[model samples]
Target: MNALMLLVQKLSCDVEEHVFSEVSLAIEKPESYFEKFKERLDERGIDSPIDQLAWISLVDALLDHDLAFELDWKESGLYICDVVDELLDRKKMAYISWGDFEDEEFDELPTSQCLNEISGKLKEVGISLAYLDIDSDSYVLITVPSSDIDDIKKMAQEAGYSIQDSF
Candidate 1:
């Protein structure tokens, strides 16, 4: 078996306790809906990173089944608030896998980045990857095959996020 499987099997032997030293980490840009959306933005010269990130995340929130929105953007904007240009930093929140990028990809054509850096990293470390759903302003992590919901919940909670079951 590969190193990751071996590690999992070994660590799982105890079922109670084991000490690990360190972790190693390792994304493919998929031809997903969000990718196509990015292309559309490129074609139209939507060059602003903030705009790109926003539209990309919005498209992710809309098109990707892995990312379902509990509260529609329009409803929140029209009834509660207004759309504005706000950016967090070099990192932007994205709902689709493609929307998330590795630090290395920042220099490349924004249209070309991995599907989901987080999932890729998790899978590399023998951890199951969970899909994220947008619950209004926050995100909910839904477990996939081989995933630990509790583990995923812990990570999200640490990041100041909460979980929801509904789509």
Candidate 2:
């Protein structure tokens, strides 16, 4: 069983994008992570609809918040699966999805089908969908050159998806 599966069992729900972001943020900046995440949610105007219970559950899973905060993720064994270099020969990447944008959800189609469509569109625009991980239903992670970010964003927008920087 992978870490994701363990987390899913712990949370008792499907792991969503926000869950991953919050966990990543918490691991990266334990002391101020929650505050920063709340600020970010406010900036995106998503704070209002936040599920407080879910947030609490996530925090509870941290186990002894104060003590946990003092430890580094690597020391604490918080495994973050990073496959960018393995899949795309890149050190940096971003996650793309139909993230709450007022666009048609790709839920009707299988993830592979949607990815194929997105890949075809990207290829048509001379962009390579080189690195991709669609393991989660809510998003796809891909490696994009910094120079090509704008181009990829535009292409994703045209394809009814939104792009977000990976945490």
The candidate scoring highest on TM-score is 2
lDDT of 1 by residue, 69-107 (tens): 222322221111111001101112222322233234332
Model 2 pairs in collision: none
Kindly give the number of clashing pairs for every candidate: 2, 0
- Over the stretch 108-153, how does candidate 2's per-residue lDDT look in tens digits? 4444444455554444434344321122233334434445656545
Off by over 4 Å in 1: 1-133, 137-143, 165-167
How does residue 153 of candidate 2 score in lDDT?
52
- TM-score between model 2 and native: 0.25
